[model samples]
Structure formats: C-alpha cells, structure tokens
Target: MTAVLPERVEVAIVGAGQAGLAASWHLVQRGVDHVVLERATAFHDWQDRRWDAFTLVTPNFQCRLPGFAYDGDDTQGFMTRAEVGAWLGRYRASFDPPLLEGVEVVGLTRAEDGFLLRTSAGELRAAQVVIATGGYHRPVVPPLGLRLPDGVVQVHSADYRNAGSLPEGAVLVVGSGQSGAQIAEDLHLAGRRVHLALGRAPRSARRYRGRDCIAWLEEMGVYDVTVQQHASGLAKRESTNHYMTGRAGGHDIDLRAFALEGMRLYGRLTDASDGVLRFAPTLAQYLDHADSVMESIKNDIDAHIARAGIQAPVEARYSPVWVPEEEPAALDLAAEGVTSVVWATGFRPDYRWVEVGVFDGTGHPTHRAGETDVPGLFFLGLPWLSTWGSGRFAGVARDAAHVAERLAARAGAPVPA
Candidate 1:
C-alpha cells in the first residue's frame, strides 16, 4: 500500500554531510526554499566508523565550508575524526540547515512539475533535485572471484575499528592508499605482524613545509583545469596529486619507509589457500616506478619556481625536499603468524536508486560544474565537480553556490519563504 505524500518544495537536497550542507547553505543564501534529506542521524557517516585515532589528511583550514572557517590557532593542524564531526555538528546548528535527518531517499524520478522523491519518512515533490551524497557511502570489497580459505578472515576498511578487531594473528592489509597505509601502520603498532599488499604508491604532499600543498593548488588554479583540456583521459585523471604525508617529522607514519623496514610488499593478492596468501613479488618494483613519477612532478615544480625567480622562503624550502623512490623490503606474514586481511581499496558511487538517465558509459553523470544533461537535475560533491578541490570541504561551497544560482534562474513555482 502507498503512503500519503507530503507537500512539495523548490529543491530537495540529498545527503546531509559536508556536500549536502554546503548546498543547503547556498540555497538559503539565494532565498530558495528547500529541504535536505539525510539517511544518518547526523553528518559525517565516516565518523561512526572511523577508528579512535583517525585524523583528516587535509588540515582544518582546508576543511572550511562556505560562509564559515575553522576557528583555531593551528590552521595547518589536521583534525581528528571526532573534532571534525563536532565541527560539522556546530556548523549545522549555526546555520540551522533545513535538514531532515534519518530520512533515507529510496527513489527519485521525474515528475510533471519537476521530480518526485520517495524517502523512508514520506514522499515529497521538488522542482529540482541535488544528489550531494559523497563518494564514501559504499565500500569496495575484494572481488568475489578471488578464492579464499575458510580460515582466512577478511574485513573492509569500513568495518575496521582498531587493531584489536583483527583476529589473533598476523594481518595483511591490501591497498596502499592513505587508508590502507594508516591501517597497516596501526596494526603494526598494536604488536601484530603486518604485511601490506603493494598496489601503487600515491604521490604524497609534504604537508608541513610552511605552505600546504592544497593551498598552493588553489592559488595555482590546478583545480580549474577541465577534463576537456587535458590531452588524454589518463592524463586528465593523473593530473591531481592525492597522496598526503605525515608532518611530524621522523616520528610520523611513513608507509613507504615502514614497508622498507620489514612490512611485506607483495604486489597483489592473487589467491589464498591453506592459510597462505600468494603475492606477486614484482609489487615492490611497480611501487618504485610510481615513486619516480611523483619525484618528477616535485622536481618540475621546483624547476618552474627557479625559472620564475620566485625567491620566497617557502618556495626555497620546498625545492630541497626529497621524495623517496624505493619500495620497502618484503616480510613473510606466515612467519610472523598474521592471519587476517583488510581491504582498503576505496569506494565506488552507486546510483541505482537515482532513476535518471544522465549517466555516462562509466555510470557517472556527465556535467559541467554541477549541471546535468537532464535539466533541473544536478550533482555535487563528486570526485572532481568543478575544480580539483571541488569535492573538498573548502572546494564544495563555490560549486554549490553556482548550482544554487542556476536553480534560482529556473522557471519553477516560488517556494514559500
């Protein structure tokens, strides 16, 4: 049986995280009547799943939303998960964002007026819909085709809480991104023998060298480069550097250095049986090649600075920093008695519930800024929406503001102020 539908609004924003919140703020500033739908009770879904020690790789200054900034002494200090969540909560309260918490949007379809949105709470109609759900909602797990022995325990990085959550044995962390590296380091510190599967070492930024890389990218207009301008799809994808290194000097966790000290550096997990995980020995070699690519980028940046005669102290300091180009030594997990695997392979956005036809061959919506092929339908908080920083807390606001402006110009019935 169908439930009674509720009143309609000008716009319906989905997801109450940073992206959704920014959208709502922009709409409010534009004097557009709207409502926000959220599945969780509060913002930051990762907050519930983040381990106790987790902190954002991007500093708090880069974590600001539109109309507000992080009020703290240490602008470059990375905030813990709890601190971030609290800040988000405070932001929500300050703006009194029209957020309907605990409302799960089950379906979205075009309506005669605009769109009909079905949620767990009730049904509502809107002239336009903005899908602001970030990319981390779905966790990517290991491929099902890969056979694993019944004795081997596997958990996605989302399910991981702490080192104690692992089974009583040595641990194998698959993936070398920030999450994978952090988890591997944590497990090793917890007295568990850890083996990290090498995928590709990402290009890491030196966070503490006076000026943060994110700020530099913003100033240099790196994010403004469009996908169309790049020569190739691979070139476009490789343009941005996503890796973040620890800033606390020698004591900080360096996955590359840690791997060199004895953590296993298997290329990839092919198959596992009889409590044995098989790895490609060439994994370390590939990682070395990846590291060289990063070094080249850094060197290029330094060369450009020298040619431009930029004698700023920060620029001078940035030139001499060394990015290593070697993979860590491999350690045998079986010898150390580690017995579990954690897949931190990242996430993929699923839009099965979004019944729109704007998706491309890759199942992602094609858009400029946040505009979609389907009129009145838009998206925000995507990996790279408008600029390189578009998805970040600081970057999302401008994109959202642009989207709200477009929405205001549409010919729809005025929503009650």
Candidate 2:
C-alpha cells in the first residue's frame, strides 16, 4: 500500500535519493521527526536513467551513505547500474525512513509558520524543507535538432539505452563529456560506426603511477577541499567533470585513441539545417585541452608523490595516437548514412516552480553551504555545494549530515551527536 501524505510535518525532505536518505538517517539518529517525499520509487534514477552498459565512473568505495559504506569484496571495482540500484535499495531498507514514494512537490513557497509545498498529492506544510532533488531536473536538447530530416531519429543522452536499440546505420553523437565519450565508446565497441562531436570537457587517466587517479586524489585531500578554498570559488560548481570510465575494470577515455580505432571525430556541433550539420573547426583545440588537463592532473600527482616521499612506479606521459589533419566543416546525414543522432549536451537547472527569492540570476539557488537566505529553506545535493564531491555519493554524506543538523537545531530539536 502507498503511504498517505501527511498534511503537516516538523520537517520535510523534497527528495529521497542518497542525499535525502542520508539526511533522513542523521535525523533518525537524533530522534527528529521528518517525512521524505519522493516523486518516484527510491533509487529509480540509478535503475532507469542510465544506459544498458552504464557503469559507475567512481569506484565502489566511494559509496558512503551515513551508515552504508560499501562492504562488497571488490572495493576498487565500479558497480553496474543494477548493482547501484540494489545498494541504494538496501540502504533504504536499513533505515525504513518515513518516505512517501509517489509524492511530487510541484511548487514551494514561504508560509507564515514555515514553508508551503504544493505537491501532486495535495498541499502540505513543512516547518523546515530540505530541497534535495539535485540539479539534473531536465535533459537539454537544442532546438536545432528539429531541423534534421524527419526520417532521422534523435535521442537525448538521458534517454539512450544502447547501440542495438537505435536505428541501424551510423550514429552521430554530439558532445564529449563523460556520457558522450562513454556512449561513443560503447557504440564503437559494438562494431557500429560512430561520429563523435568533441566539446571542451577535460579528460583524466583511469590509473596513474600504480594507483587509480581517484585514489591518488583522495590521498592528496583534493576531494575534501571546500568550494571557498578553491581558486574558482563558487564558479567551480559550473565546471564540467573530468571524463574517465570505470567500465571493464577502469581505463582512460582517450578520444584520440578512439579515433585511431576507426571512430570519426569532429569539433563541436554548431548548427543543423536542411539535413546537414555544421561543425566548428576546433576539434584539435578540444582534444589538446583534454590532453593538457590530463597532464596537469598527472603533474599534480607527481608533485604530491615527491612531497610525500612515496615510492610508486613512474609512468610515462600519454602521446596522441591520431590527430585530425583538417577539420570536417560539415556532414550530410544522408550521404554519411547516419540514421540517428544523440545529443549528449549537459542539463540546465530548472527551479521555475520554486516561488522563493533564494535563487540567483542563473536560476541556481543562492546558499551558503546549503543554508539559503530564506530562513527555513535549504538546498542540498547541488554540485560543489560545499566541495567538488557535494553532489556525488562520495561527498553527499557530509553535506546531508550538515543540513540535517542545521534543520534540527533550527526547529529547536536536539542536533545529531
């Protein structure tokens, strides 16, 4: 039976993902009364949003919820999509939180006593609300996609399942972030012709100097540095994550290497019209930027190793396997036999339903470590909320704990020990 929505609550959590569930765990420990509202079943995104071949980019050890650190034998291996869903399911069962699975909070506004939430079920009042729905609310597909021929099938990265599911023929994948790069590799590995449009997103080596880049960074305290301590400050939140894959025991995602293996690479997609796509002549720049970023990371790792006097095997730097001699300015879809297009562009934040003044000009919530200017409204699960790991499983635990403590204290309840 579905849980009935409560008309009022001492505290309300607007999402039930890892971030919100972590908060619930902390609240439960402190004996704080709160209800968690989830738009769908818990951990639905982990099971549904990812493609058939999707594996975690981060290692299993980073799966650190409040009381649920990964206990599996393969601590260094990445979890498959189903494994991730099951892990989150186990976490949910461990706490049995007061969760309304189908409750969708459509609108939120300030109430006289606290905050008023207009949800799909009905109106409810929460003295303190934790918005943990995360930043990826909508998939961004450009309007130019419509200009392509009607016969061509276009799918957003969020909706893509696998190469076998797409129409037979060559596939044009536009974007080179984590999703775009990995998806292209998936298609290429499946013996499908792939045309990948590169972007400015940086890349990272999977393993370096006899250790995973993530492990090295962890030992260097890179993930623990607060957003305020970084040179970019809050602006660091806008940076695209460096791309690497944990698929098949982990490896670097080198687009140039993919090019050497018969994958067609192009610059950023500028426009599409009359069944023809135009690309900017910046393919070399994109590839060069990605390589430089990877090298910079290795440089940092070398410095850390030197400073710590750690004995690790020295690894040589990467060299480009293939480089584009001349940029491909345009491509006719019909001529190239491209039957499908995948728009792997990133998402934009959508807070139109929020009727509060705590957001900035860019529609991002303005907060100091999840505490908004609005007294009882807090935003959690945002990238770089406190650190680079704020929105990720590796870091959400700390952010959730901090938010739960603040919310409990604000409501005159005992804070978590």
Candidate 3:
C-alpha cells in the first residue's frame, strides 16, 4: 500500500486566530496563494472561553488585525468578547484567503518540498509554514484534582464561560493573574462567596495621571519592548497580565479589591487532597509586589507627562481598594461549602502537533522576530517575538505581517497576478 500525498500550496497557516488572520491578510495583499487552517469556526478560541463580562485589556484602537483597524468610537475604551469576535469575523469575511474552518492540524511533518500538515480535513503540503495559533493553548491545570472527591466541580479559566454555569455554592478561584482576578470578581459579583488564590502579577491603576495606564504604555513604547532587552528568555516568557478590569472604562482589579469585597484571599495554591488545599505563604508578598509595581508605573507615567510637557488633569478624589490581611496557607474547600473551583491558571501551547524541533527550553519557538530555525518555518504569536505586545492583541498584526513577508520573500511569494 502506498501513502497518499497531500495537496500543496505556497503557504500553510495553522490556527485562524488574530496572528493567522494577520498573516493571511499580508499573504493575500502580496498576491500569495495560501490556506488558513482553523480548528474552530470562530476566530478567537480564548475569546469564546472568556466570561460574559470579559473585555480586552488593550483598548479598542489596538484591536487591529493585518489590514483592518478598529473603526468604532471606542478606540480608547476596551471591547467586549462578543465585539472582538464579531470584529475578527468581519475581517475574515472581507478577505479572500482560502480558509478552512473546523479543521484541526493533528500533525505537521517537514516534507522534502516544504511541510506536510495532517489535518482533520486532509493533508496539505506547502512551501512555507506559519504557526499563528496565538499564545493561549492548552489550559495549565494542576493534577491536584485527582486527590479531591468526585463532588467538586473544577474548570480551568479557558473552560470557564460565566458564573451562572457553576453550581450554587462558594467558589474557589486559583491563580491571581488577569483571568483569575477577573473571574473571581465575576463570581463575587454574581452573589457567590469567592476565594481567590493570590499569584504574582504587576498591577496598575485603571487610569494613571488621568489617562489609561495602557495609553502610558503606548506613549512610552513599553509595549514595543523586545525579548532582547529582557534579562533572559524566562523573563521574556513571563506573563504581562495586569491586575485590572476592562469593564466600564477600566478599573483597578487588585486582590485587595476582591478582598475588600469580602472575597476570601489565599496565597499560591500548592497541594490539594480530600478537599483540603495547601498554599504557599506568599499572599502578603504578592500584595506588596502589586503595590510596588503600580507605584512604579504611576511614577513612570508622571515622569513621562512632566518630561513631555503633556497637560493632564490634577489628582482629584481618589478611591483605593483597601489591602486586607492574607489568608492562611491552607483552605478547607469542602467544609467552606465551596462547590465550584475555577482554575483561572491560564494555558500553555501544546506543540505536539508540530513535528519540527523549534522549541526552546521554555517551550517557546526559537525565532528571531517571526522567522524560526527552519528556513521556511516561522512563528507569529509568542510573547515578545518582536515586541512586548507580540503575543498580545497589538503585536499580532505586526508580527504576522513580518512573518508573512519573510515567507513571501523566501518563496518569491506566489501571489495571484
């Protein structure tokens, strides 16, 4: 029996998220013939997983795809999950990229011609390959659940949709990053007793010096910081999620706020068995660290305003979330009547699909900008690939364009003339 060969194209793009769409945009503009293979119909996998009140941390203006920019009036404001999904969907419709939906790339092998992508639909050979699956991949949930009783309800943040979906009881949200903090708030606001496990994160005031902290980051080129400037690859791989909410013009989302709202606060979740959770003694340090980061951000923003001679409003009435005492390093979830546990722990890329050995020790693609170690292979959505925003909303388009252009230049881009 002979194995069947796959259909070939100039380029094979994996994942139809923001990064993939951006790459598709540039490839089409350059007249390159390509196919964007998407595992899901909707462009955003994380967006669909977000809670009901989820919104982009970046502003609307930064909601840019490859060839299109956000044209709505809420450029400075944040966009909701539905709005972003709709926006990306619209962008997909506007382009003529040969995109196949509901097609999962099960395996990618380096072929003699280019690369062979084994997908649910069929196999495809391409001169170049672009992995634009965005940063968020498989959820990173701990195996502590195996020790717990069968009655406990546990779901990672990626699997979480809203608070209403959970059982009627106190909720325990692990991980204090953006998702964890935000979901804790969601559950708390939904009238459930919430317990938030504190994780290390750099937080900021929703508005610093009368402008959004994100605006300060934009003006200061903070988002453009590259991995080269970072201390190490590990530092570069660190999460940039801020402890702030994108709701109602954005606001601070400190563990302190959740604490003040009567949410039980615990430190890093460590071990769990028989419904008992052990935690690290780091909640106080987390609070102090969050405060320090926020202050540093404010000082930097203030310095930028003064140095740039930018007129800003004077500090008026200030409302601060009161920092509360940290919880003990142990939690009795079963006794506390906590029926639901939300592992807002975030995701890690599952590269088992890619046959290429391009991953570093940190599990990220070893590439300069978007070009990988292999000649024609590239990556677009790793954090700080080109800038701090590379793995984020702002950097996806730019990085995608860069990677697409590189692939095009290498192949003399077989765009339709």
Task: Please name the candidate that would achieve the greatest TM-score relative to the true structure.
Answer: 2
Give the TM-score ranking, best first: 2, 3, 1
lDDT of 1 by residue, 146-253 (tens): 565556688888888898877898788888776787778778778777887866656545532345655555555665765566455423433333455432321234
lDDT of each: 0.71, 0.90, 0.80
The global Cα lDDT (0 to 1) of model 3 is 0.80
Q: List model 3 lDDT by residue over 133-240, tens digit each.
A: 876778888888677778989898888888899998999998888888888888887889998887887777788767888878888988887778766654656665
Clashes of each: 8, 0, 3
Greater TM-score among 1 and 3 belongs to: 3
Model 1: residue 84 alpha-carbon error in angstroms: 0.8
Q: Which ten residues in a row have the lowest lDDT in candidate 3?
A: 316-325
Deviating ranges (above 4 Å) for candidate 3: 1-6, 42-47, 232-234, 316-327, 414-417
* Tens-digit per-residue lDDT, 22-74, candidate 2: 99998888888889999998768877679998999888888899999986889
Model 2 TM-score (2 dp): 0.98
How do the predictions measure up, each by TM-score?
Answer: 0.86, 0.98, 0.93
Question: Cα deviation of 398 in candidate 3 (Å)?
Answer: 1.1
Scored by lDDT, the top model is 2
Question: Judged by TM-score relative to the true structure, which candidate is superior, 1 or 2?
Answer: 2
